[model samples]
Target: MNTLVTGRRLARELGEWRSTGPAYRALADRIRVLLMDGRLASGTRIPAERELSGALGLSRTTVAAAYSKLRDDGYLASVRGSGSTLVLPGLERGDHAPGSGLPLDFTKAVTLAYPGVAAAYAAAIEQLPAYLAHDGFDMVGMPDLREAIAQSYRNRGLPTSAEQIMVTTGAQHALNLVTRSLYSPGERVLVEQPTYPHALDTFASVGARMLSFPVSQDGGWDLSEAQLQLRRAAPSMAFLMPDFHNPTGTSMTIPEREFLTAAATREGTVLIADETTALLDIDRGALPPLACFSPGVITLGSLGKIAWGGLRIGWIRASRDVLARILRNRPAQDLGTPLLEQLAATSLVRELPVLAASRSRDLKLRRDMLVQLLGEQLPEWDVAVPDGGLSLWINTGTMSTSALALAARSEGLGLVPGPRFGLDGAFERFLRLPFGHDVEQLRDAVKVLGRISSRVGPDPLRMPLQAVI
Candidate 1:
């Protein structure tokens, strides 16, 4: 019998292991993990049906079903005798996955640890069996976890209640659910230019019209332009990261927050305040959340940045009315976030002091290293040292980041171009470099990037920044 070695061979080389099981589920899960981990390069040819099924000890019919699902998910390509192959692009495991042996992965923004987490998780798991007798489908979330989240917000000066909280798969799912519930097709939404790149894609999928305002590295958002867009567009919803905004790391000023929220209130614009990165406040004495200023804001908070991305639990704090509407909309997307993860997050949340301490040390160390490295090696590049967060937004001014990324990729390095975060490719002159990796890994990536940057053409910011005001 043909080992069907070629398909299993190539796939296994990329870490797609085959499994023998009563159900094809084990094999299916293996395929999903490979894709999610990015081992399955998008557009790669897959193995033949007969080959894979036989090699993996699964029924041909089972293999066919698995392949069909993968195909539906854009993870595999189908052909005749050539068979299917792993082919999926970027995917999230909900929380941060610790770095494996990949050469370089500066694309993700995650730190090493928020310490004391293991202990908390262990305790939570130990406590989990006590409740395992009941079904763990916590769509609304656990009361204890909800209380912890609400308490955290209250500690930060935002009035929160367990009644207002709803746990989710992640901030991504939370955003999707909020958009679906509150906004309509053809309704307008506003985001920062060069915002969280993936969010634009997610929001766009729901047919939300997008308007972006420029926010500078010095951290000034175009208030006038934003107000104009809100008034003219009368957007039904808006997503703001008032704290440690993505890409540029711009935080909204108290004045800006007050003015914007007042206008949004007048126009009845529902604000999606993504506080996901806000907890990463290295400033120690950072201002209160924008949600504190506006009752209309539906704040989204997650454990991914502060604790671990793998925790896969985020919550939204909204009015009772909005909560009811969101609850109604929940069934279409997901049945509920897994009860186990909720338990994990709850355990983590209660242990914030220990987690926050470790995260602070970890992020501060990485940030310092990146700043020193960038200053010493890539001085020509305009890089901002953000107050908090796992990444750096470096201005390669007027350079083609796409070309730079391609060159780096060829050198066994991975990077996402700035335009990936911009609509109509606005930030082609910039790039977001995550220092959220092992120090050794980050240093290596910077070295490779230094080489790539050197080979590239002259930078447009060659002219001195006339005023760093």
Candidate 2:
């Protein structure tokens, strides 16, 4: 079924859309920005021109011109009776399209493979022969791998057993499995305002009605608002990243975690915590896992950031009952986690602390270097240096980050706009710049951005938001 965005809703999402352009162009640009930001899903039926014009208190001619501009830009397709439908160029909805052959892609916050990954793979191949005697379709995961994952939790001060674990291909796959198993269509789901973009895609893919509270750079998680929403909306599930949060790079305090856990318990909301970036700590030290405060919390962990992106190993630490529920629905999504990957993961888990130390050292150097470069090159921008996490969340101050992104694209730099990280087109001025690249690459990207910033106006060229890898 095609999703429809009513005129009133679209107007609400427009959120002070005016920019330095003609009314029609500004309107069209805002719509295009919204589409690229994932605020407007591809294949969604847009409101009719007249309906939108009335809703925004604009003339029909202006709305018609805006629609015409959007159609010309390949963002909308018009049908006679049915209204215009949003479309991304050269691809359909749910398709995984690569970046625009750009030399530097800042859309992903991942680094290259860890140095120990190759040896781990070799170890996995050696261990694989022993497992070949039995059928390789592993739905629940191997006992050894599960135990390793459980031990990781135990080391973190959270007591987890093997039965409470379910391994998947990656953190993304784990999130998908958990969301599909736990959430029903049309159910309310709460999330951080600026979260992992792909996580937003996950919730949206499930037809979830999302509610959000702000995750500010200075204020951190808005506990008061979250509590109010939990009590008022009573959402079924709340997805969160309490440690080294994506985009924001801020973690919640222990008191905040306990408060949220208590509130969610009272509201019957299950907290699904993504700890994919939990161990990416640089100097902030460890905070207790969100699950430590509540048994109902479901935590997702991954080796993508710490070990290697290509390794493709992640697991869910939930109750035994929740693991069973996920297992029952697993086959429809995938046959099982790969045997070789699990074996490699097992080896990597044991080497985590060493890998983490190495990773932290490298990350600290790159992060500090990137921060210095950005600060020197772009002094006007408000760049926050996070203690840990993959990226620096920047407030572009006077410069529209979306515009900066568009301008940077001409210089062969790919970036995810701020709105892509949040719901309903928020965070337009913010940008997530990952320092997971070589210092040279980081320097070049920042120099390009600084150069482009001066040339591009506030109304940057609107482009599609790439599916985060």
Candidate 3:
């Protein structure tokens, strides 16, 4: 179904609207920024010029001029009687708005394949002959791979058994399976304010109503508020990324984990912890996995970050009952995990610690380099140096990151803007910059960002909204 932004809603999203340029240009630019940031999703219907003008207390002429600017810029289309519809430039061509087959892609936080990945594949092929006698199709996962995954959890101070694991093609595949199996239509799902974008996509696809709490780079999780929401909303489930928590890169403290676990158990809310980036550690020492705090917590683990994303193997660690429920629903989406991928994942799991150490050393170097480049080039922007995780969550003070992202596209750069991580048009001034690229690529990205930052200028509504002078 297509989204239609009402006049009142768009007016609220537009905020203060005024900028250094002409009013019409500013209005059009803001709309373009919103579209770029994913706050105003593609294919959404824009209000008629006269209706928007009336809503914002502007003349129809000004609104018409704004619409004309957007149309000329390839951001809007109008029909005689059907009204205007929003269009993202590259998306109309069936490509991503940014990084659609682009050479320099920063939209993904993953890095190049690990050095040992090739060896694992070779070993998997050698081990393949033993399973040739049986039918290749398997749904629950191969026995060896499940045992390896379970042992990994045991190493992490959490007890596990092979019966508690179910392998999937990737972490995303696992998340989708879990969401579909557990959530009912219109049920409330709790999430962080600026969580992973694709996770938000999965939740929305299920028609789940979302409630959020803030997770700041400095302050970490707002546990008090999270507890309040748990008590008040009584959501069906709470999706969390507790370890190096996605864009923010802040892991939950041990006490915070225990506190949250207790709260969830009391409220009867199921907590799903995404540990995809859990092993991507730099200087942050080990923290207890959220599942260790409570048996009810369902954990998602993946080798995508620690090894190679192309390996495409992940698992869900849940109680036997939940695992059984997930297995029953699994075939509706996929027949089974690939035999070749499972063999490779088993081989990789045995060497997990060695691979993780190698990845950590490489990530630390890249993180330091990226931080230095951003500090020297774009000093005005507030950047948090995350101890773990692959990205930096930047606070672009007084500047609209959505505008910066739009401008970067002209330079052949791809960026996922801040609002992509939040709901209801929040995080417009924030951006996630991944440090998983090569040093040279990071340098080039910083240069492009520095150039674009100056052109993007300050956000008009940086301060509280008040009566215009």
Candidate 4:
């Protein structure tokens, strides 16, 4: 079914879209950015030109021209008696394949596969035949794999049992399952303002109303605003990344974690902690998992980032009751996590410490290289060097990264603009540059940024106060 974007909704998404260019072209460019960044999905029907014009208080001619430009660029399709629908040109709708036809794709914040992955898979293959006679649909997880996942939690100081684990295809799948089981339609879901973009996608898929608190690069999580939202909104669920938060690599201090968990518990809200990036630690020492504070907090873990993105294995660590609920709802989405991957994951989980150490050494070198390159080449841009996580969250000062991304794409580089991590088109001046790629690629990406910095004009967009914590 095709989704319809209302005029009011489009206006909210097009926050501060105007720039120092023709209004129509600027509007079209902003829409393209939204589409490319996966905020505004492909194949959705947009509001009519007249409706959008009234929503933005612009002339109908301007809206018409914007729509015309989108059609010209093959980003939209129009049919008589039907509205204009967004299209992605050559790619299928909702396709998230790795390659973007760009030479340098910094859109993903993933790292190279852990070196031992092939050996683990080989070990799994030798062990796979032992279970060929049984039904292949393993709903919960293989017993050994679940135990391995539980042991990982125990190593982190959060006592866990195999019964508390339910493996999924990946962390994203685990999140989807949790959201479906926990979130009620129309109930509010609280989130970090600039969170994992796909987490927002999952929440939006359920049509859940969202509230957000800030996680700034300098000041850390805004607990005051978080408490206010929990107390005021009483949202049904709150999504968080306490350890090595995406975009901004700031982890929550122990006090902040304690307070937030206590606050959510008081408000009767379900706290879901995404720990996909937790194990990607480069230098920052271990912090207690959020689950350590509250048994009710649901924790999601995956090997995708720590091992390889190709290894589709992740598990949810929750109370037995929560696991039971998730298990009951699991089959509707997928029958089971692949048995072969689980066998491989069991071995990988056992060797997590070794993998983490290896990733740390490599990540530190690349992170330092990218930081030095950016500092030397684009000194005007403010960059916060994160101790861990795959990317650097940069403040482009006055340059509009949406424009920067559009310009960079033409130069054979693909970048994700700051607004992709934010809601209501916030963070236009910020950019996320992943340091997980090769040193030469990082150097080249920075060079591209430096070269185009002058051409991408300044944007006056500010974070909307209502969306901020």
Candidate 5:
């Protein structure tokens, strides 16, 4: 018996229904469920896009997109000859946890797309139908979009080129591409302790000799000290989030960036400046890209935080030579980003004001609301009012964030403890809570946390919040 339904099954079930989403996702998700449960055996060919789209009265592009997501995740494989086949290959714990159904998903350091973006995406689709006759894999990107991104960088006082850009699936993909191309497994990689969780995770998975440098809540970094650590650890490469650094929401000065880039350059190390969170800054001025200070740096940027995480779009700005290296590394890990998402992101980038204004209003409100709520409800917790970014780094008096996290998870709250962001459990006394959620949800969450915090004794709360900055 056939397990996962082919597109033919969806055609039969929907029977020329023209509705979008709800119905669209139902068909896609049902197939995913079957594949996950081992019902969808490998080597089964899904129906052709034209056939299914016509049969269900759905746009071919929509079906194509669902297929694209599955393709990206390694769930389905397609080639010029073989058609798509079922292949949910990974066996991982996080995969089993599933998507969030709650009003608040603090774990996401990303913004939800604006309501009007649907129209913008639809516009891209309308535009795509016209372009279908041409070669789709224009690897560098749509030229207009490249020029737009280059302009954005220029606006921020950093010089860039369309040639320096390569559109990617997201910041994660961009970093991974750079990492794979720039350094080999077992290479020494230096990272900020209490850094973006995925960076450490990525470095470690590559079997790199990973070293963690300190970053502070009150003190960002002292150059001389960091230089010593760099000399001592002798890392082959480093990943940085210089602008509005993740989880901690710290921003580096131009001087600091210059010093860091110089130090890394002198040490003969490649600096991967993950600028994924750069533009969300509510701060007063522009902080130029670390690449401005050193030509030898790889910088990652994305539409995720600026436009929406659903865009699944990011880019790497590096020299033309490094771009070639990243291209050679691409096929081993990913083919390339889905063409549709890239198109949508490109449109979104051109409409920069809409995206920036939406981000500014939403994030500013959410950030302010969170600060007030935490102050009112969890007065005992010492939380930093960040300069920018979606999350607040808390100096949780207690070192055992695991206890609070476990306690919170029981109440349907996902707490990303500082240790998850740290290499040596050094941020044991720190905790990260995203201000990305709305006021009501943040209020409720703080109440839940405050209730949990109330029960802990003074001793557990008195431990010095370690600064692994």
Candidate 6:
């Protein structure tokens, strides 16, 4: 079945899309960005021109012109009886690949593997033979791995048990299981305003009605708004990243964490805290995990960031009852996490402190290098230095990152526009630049940004394509 995007939803997604250029051209550009960023599925049917015109308060001719422009660029396909459908030229329908096939792909916020990962895998292989005789289908993690994961939490001052841990393929998979188990058809899910885009995708997959609260780099999480939403909406689940938030890279203050957890408890909202990037600490010391504040908070942790992205090991730390619910629903999606990966994960989890120390040294060096390069090249841009995490959240002031990303692609650079992290087309002027690359790559990326920064100004649509490319 083809997904149909409503006119109102389209308008919301096209937030602040107007530029100094013609409205038709601006609309077409925004739609293209949405399709390129995987915000809008290619095979989905968009609203009719007249319906979209009504939604945007524009004339039908303007909407028709925009649709015509999209068609001319091979982004929209219209049929006589069927509605206009979005399409990516030269790519199959629903083919939203991760990178742009460009050099310097900064779309993902990940880091180089910890140097000790290979040795850990080797160690896991030595121990794997003993467990080879079993069925090896591990829905709830290996006993040793679960205890190690639980002990890692206990090391952080949070009491946890192997009984509370259910291993999964990765943090994203764990989130899928959590959402499928907890979220009903129409229940609202509250999330950070600018959060992990894949988390938004996971929630949307279940047809969830999502509400948002802000988490700014300057002011941190908006607890006031979070409390308001919790009280008013009474959402079933609230997804959070209190430690080293993905795009923003801001960790919540102890007071902020306490307040939010207390508020969620009051409203009976289940807190789903994603600690995927929790241990990516640079300067920031250990703060208590969100699970410490509330027993109901379901925390998701993975080795993908700390150890290596290839290590598909993540676990859900929730109450035993919640684990039971997730376990019951787990078989519908996936059977078990790979046993070899689990064995490797157990070794890594035990050596997490050593891995974290190594990552911290490397990340700090790269983070400082990227910040210095950006300071030298793009001095006008506001770049906040995060204490930890893989990326830097930048405020490009008036520049539309969607337009900037389009221009960057021509320069052999890949960038994720800010709106990809936001809801309702927010954060168009913001950008998340991952600083996990080498010093040379960082220097080249900055040079590319510096070269195109002036070209992609406040009015991205008005920028001459010939000049940018």
List of clashing residue pairs for candidate 5? 214-469, 215-468, 215-469, 216-469
Task: Please report how far candidate 2 places residue 166 from its true position, in Å.
Answer: 0.2
TM-score on alpha carbons, each prediction: 0.77, 0.91, 0.91, 0.96, 0.77, 0.94
Best by lDDT: 4
Q: Please write out the lDDT profile of model 6 over residues 187-287, one tens digit for every residue.
A: 99999989999999999999999999999888899888999999999999999999989899999999998999999999999999999999999999999
lDDT by candidate, in order shown: 0.73, 0.85, 0.86, 0.89, 0.71, 0.89
Q: In terms of lDDT, which candidate is stronger, 1 or 5?
A: 1
Q: Which residues of candidate 6, in runs, are more than 4 Å off?
A: 90-95, 460-469
Across 265-324, the per-residue lDDT of candidate 3 in tens digits comes to 999999999999999989998887899999999999998989899988998999989988
RMSD of each candidate? 12.0, 4.0, 3.2, 1.8, 15.1, 3.8
Q: Rate residue 407 of model 2 by lDDT.
A: 60
Q: Across residues 188-299, which tens digit of lDDT does each residue of candidate 4 receive?
A: 9999979999999999999998899999978899999999999999999999999889989989999999999999999999999999999988889999999999999999
Clashing pairs in 2: none
The TM-score that candidate 4 achieves is 0.96
1 or 6, greater by lDDT: 6
| Model 1 misplaced regions, further than 4 Å | 1-102, 459-469
Better of 2 and 5 by TM-score: 2
Which ten residues in a row are the worst by lDDT in model 2?
A: 460-469
Give the poorly placed runs of model 2, Cα more than 4 Å off: 79-81, 92-100, 457-469
Cα error, candidate 5, residue 4 (Å): 34
Candidate with the greatest TM-score versus the true structure: 4
